[model samples]
Target: MLTTSQILKKVKELEIKSKRLTRHLFTGEYHSAFKGRGMSFKEVREYTAGDDIRFIDWNVSARFNHPFSKLFEEERELTMMLLADISASSLFGTVLARKKDMVTEIGAVLGFSAISNNDKVGSVLFSEDIEKYIPPKKGRDHGLYIVRELLTREGKKKGTDISRALRYLNNTTRQKCIVFVLSDFLDPGFADALRVAGKKHDVIGIKVYDPMDMQLPDAGVLEIEDAESGQVARIDTSDYLVRKAHQDAFFRHSEWCKQVFTRAGCDLLHISTKEDYVKVLQKFFIGRT
Candidate 1:
């Protein structure tokens, strides 16, 4: 737990760093990747050579005896929601910052990006259940508040329930939003809710993990514990078969997660604790462009 002053200082640091990224790194990429809401109907005009025939107003064309087309303008404002997982598993990291820290930084960056572009930003922090819900709001202070919450908030529950979080998001928000779910993704049974949410919103999955999560260090026999379940077991890392099996299982689970996101029509990004996430995020944005 962090003290009030410590939390405030950390929040300020993240706010400044995120703002810098928002200005130089994400400002344009974020805007281009996530367009404004679908075009809104405007006035109708006589059809031009370049206009699509499908949009022709049949009734108006019949009355005027000329082809007419409907025009539309893009809605400027958008809503962005961050769904962060604060489960016990996120507390384990072997290199760099922990998974939770990475998630918080990424969430702050997204919030700053949204607010910088004059969009409403909100968040739902969850573990086994929703821990806190911040209503969508615009302005710098709201963004700062979100950063503070991300830094100080702790998960009360042990396990992760991504399905519950998705269902809550679906029930709470009606309008289309750019939803970003950040987690280690060490949970199960979320595909259905993810698919449903994807149908309504632009869902993106950001999976942050450590190298140790996939491979075990050759430290001979060691005791390993499950962070969420509190189950402890001893594993002989010196044994080649045990290491191979652990690696294989981790790889299999990672692939399965990718498929789930793909089936739900969501974009997925995997970042390791040892890597530079800023570059990864920049690459993702550029790819979207």
Candidate 2:
């Protein structure tokens, strides 16, 4: 646990770093990536050549006996929500940072970027249930609060249920939002809920993991604890079959994440704790642009 002063200091550090990255590295990329995401209907006008047929106003056209079209203006402001997993599994790290630490940094950066663009930013922190929901709001203070919460908050439960968070999100917010789901993705059976949420919002899944989650070191004998279940077991890492099984488990989880996100028509990014997540985020934003 972190002391009050300690948490305050860490929050300030992250806020500064995240603001710098948002200002210099992510400002333009983030803007261009989500530009024109929210569009609002403006007015109806006579159809012109090369107008999108999908936007045609059929009823108005029939009333006037001519083709008409609906015009839309891009919404200048967008809302961003971070669906962060604060599960116990996130505490396990064998490299630069724990999964939860990486998630906090990424979430802070994203919040700063959104606020920089004059957009509203919020978060939904979850363990097995909906822990908290910070409604979308603008300003530096709100962003700072989010960073503080992310840095200090720990899971109150054991496992992760992404569907619960998604359902909560759908029930609470009626507007279309840019949603970022950050997790180790250790749970399954969230496809249906994810698909439903994706249809109404722009959703992205971020998988934060550690090297140990993929493969165990070739130590002779080691005791490992399941963070979620609090179960401990001894295994011989030197055994080839044991290592293979570990790798295979990670592969299965990765594949399931990919399939679920793909089927829901959402984007998914994987970042290792040892890697530079800033570059990965920049590349994703640029690719979207």
Which number leads on lDDT?
Answer: 2
RMSD of each: 3.7, 5.0
lDDT of each: 0.93, 0.94
RMSD of 1: 3.7
Model 2 worst lDDT window (10 residues): 31-40
- Candidate 1 lDDT by residue in tens digits, 24-62: 999999988999977898889999999988889899999
What would the per-residue lDDT of candidate 2 be over residues 90-155, giving only the tens digit for each residue? Answer: 888998899999999999999999999999999999999888889999999999999998998887
**Superposition error at 108 for model 2 (Å):** 0.3
**What does candidate 2 score on TM?**
0.88
